[model samples]
Each structure stands twice: as structure tokens, then as C-alpha cells.
Target chain A: GAGVSQTPSNKVTEKGKYVELRCDPISGHTALYWYRQSLGQGPEFLIYFQGTGAADDSGLPNDRFFAVRPEGSVSTLKIQRTERGDSAVYLCASSPDRVNEQFFGPGTRLTVL
Target chain B: AQSVTQLDSHVSVSEGTPVLLRCNYSSSYSPSLFWYVQHPNKGLQLLLKYTSAATLVKGINGFEAEFKKSETSFHLTKPSAHMSDAAEYFCVVRLERGGNQFYFGTGTSLTVIP
Candidate 1:
């Protein structure tokens, strides 16, 4: 079975640019989540969606970060005016439902230079 | 507030020896705990999770964790260490404080020696 997957395993962009990272959750999964991992640290939650609507977006650091999942299976994490602090491995995860363990993706490493 | 702490930043164990990784948590609500492992340059994999079920939870790769609400601890353990077990371990706690979110620890790097 296919696991959660993120595209462009690696992305390098300049500061003050805009970027979008995509995630394809496992088929039939209604729960999708996004997280960010910095060097020598664990992943921090970013956003989560159940079905077509976002169930939670509190983890998003600021207004510059936004995500949407209109179809409930594919989600995108968008960053505007990227900063050096935005450089991190963006991880996506999905589960059968809420309150269950989640499976993760290979993640997209974004580097700002 | 909800938070998790990996007491040790790193743990070195000889192959075939016992492995123990300590974790403690604090949450205003009843928290759901999880253990995830990440190999170098790889994505995080679920090792085990402790929800509102049995306190002792067993997971893949012969790993298990016991949740103790009294102490607010969920320590992961394996009877014997394997060379492939070398990786970074993260303790996570989930809560619905206002909205659903997961809090992760700094992570504990496990080094298995032969």
C-alpha cells in the first residue's frame, strides 16, 4: 500500500520568495497532517485536515503559512515571503482517522538561502 | 498546556542488551502519547502509541512502552537491542486544547554498539 508521500524531496529557494509543498496522503485516509522539523529537533505540528476542511491550524506559526485540502486527499503547505527560519524538513502524515497513530512521508526539505 | 520531554538526548547500548528511553509529559487534558523513530535521512515511523487503552502498549520491531498516568510517564523499552535500532526517537503527546495538536520532544538519539 502507498504511504503518505511528499513531492520534490528537496527544495531550495531564496529568502522572501514564495513556495508550495504538496502532500499525497494514503488512499482512503481522511486525516492529513503537516509538521516541520528543524535540525536536531523533533517535528512540530503545522496543520491537520479531516475530510475537506481543516480541523486544526493552530500549529501554523503565523499568517504567512497556510494550507488547504479541498478534495480531502491532497494537501499543500504554502509559505509566503520565506525566511531563513522557514528552512526545515516539512513532513506530512495521515491516519485512518483521528485518535489513531499516523504514518509519515519522506518529507520535503526546504532550504532558504 | 501540553508538553513532552525526552530525559536523555542520547543513549548508547551494546547489541543484545536492554534498551530504555525515558519520557515524561504534562497535559491539562487526557493526552494521547506516541513514539516515533526516524533513521538517518528517512521519514519518521511509528514505533508505538498509548491512547486511552491499556497502559502497556506494544509496537513494531519488538518495541513497547508503558504509560503511567500517576507519574505522567511513558517510557519506551525493548528486551534486547539490535544494531538496526540505532536512530532518533521522539516522544509525542496529542491534545485538543482549543484545537488538535501534537507536541514533540527534542528527541533522543540512540546509538547501538556491536
Candidate 2:
């Protein structure tokens, strides 16, 4: 892809439901990141991946949240037992390398009812 | 650990007027500073960055920022504000020697009056 791309730009799900958000990074990028943004707040780091391995998952809020980049390209963020507080924009970004500048996607607005 | 503080939540300026948005950062080591802008319903756009190259860094749309180590500030400035400049701005800080993570400030909203 020319830029980072996210699927399902808007997602509406009920509480306790499971949801999966996808991210397609630019071609040949080796680093991917996920973030969450609440209203009136800046994006908060969720997780980071280097190639197919998760280098930093410390930012994941809890056990309910998990992300995987199976082939060092596309990534998926899985949320289990979603709660209303999970309503926010989920953003994805990618960089050529772990230390380079990141390019962001349009983001998916997740709304949990 | 690194954090950014955007001093002003909102700032308004008339067209052709000078613009200023204040930001302060805290980091354990020398920091990589950045400014990103977000238009309504859009992704973030990097405005400028200070990666220890020069204290005065210029960016797109005639915007620029000066990194002041003594003041611990990286303030965005524009000599002439345009209506198109109205948007939300964020200040970000990254640790020079860390896990390559970036910390962002809450953000500052800029209103340009015609």
C-alpha cells in the first residue's frame, strides 16, 4: 500500500462482544504500531511490532487486548469482551524501521455500546 | 520516560497575524521533538522535527519550531497565520535512547479568524 491502511473505518459493537481491527502497513515497512485515542486526548500507545514479533506489548491495557503481525506486513488488533469505555479511535502506523518516522492511517472509530 | 505538555489548550489569531503554540517536554535523555497537525476527521501530519540537527527547524505550510534546551521547550511558530492553519496541533517527545516510543501532549486547538 502507498500508506498505512485500516479496515472498517467505523466499527459499532455491543458490550461483551469481540472485535478485530486490521491494519495494512506500507510495502516493505518492518515496524508497525497501534494506538488508541479518546475524545479530547492524544493517541495512547497500545503495542509495537518488529517484523513478525511483538517487541513491545507493554502498552496493551489488559489481557482483553491483543495484536498480531503474522507476516511483518498486515496486523490485527483483537479486543475481547469489549466494554463501553473502549469507544475511541484505533490508529495504526508503520515505519521503515523501528527507529524511523511513522506514517499513520485514517484510523478506525470503534464504538462499544 | 518522556512526556509533553501543551501549555495552551486553545489559541486564536487573525489572518496574517503571528502565531505561537507553547510546548514543554520532560525526558530522561536528549529528546527528539516533533509537531504534528490534525485537520478535522484526518490523520496526523508531521509538521516538523528536531533530531539534534538544528535548534531552529522549519516545516511545511510556513511553520517552524525552535528547540530551547534551557527552557525545555519546543514551541511552534508562524510569522503569518492563514485560515488554512486552523486545526489541532500536538507536541511530541521521544527519548533519545529508549524503546523508540513517542509521547504526545493532549493537543492545542488553533482558530484562525479571517
DockQ, structure candidate 1: 0.86
TM value for model 1:
0.97
Give the Å error, residue B32, model 1.
Answer: 1.3
Clashing pairs in 1: none
Q: Write the per-residue lDDT of candidate 1 for residues A1-113, one digit (tens) a residue.
A: 88888997999999999999999999999999999999998998999899989999988999999999988899999999999999999999998998788999999999999
DockQ of each: 0.86, 0.69
| lDDT score, candidate 1, position B100 | 70
DockQ of structure 2: 0.69
| Model 1 DockQ class | high
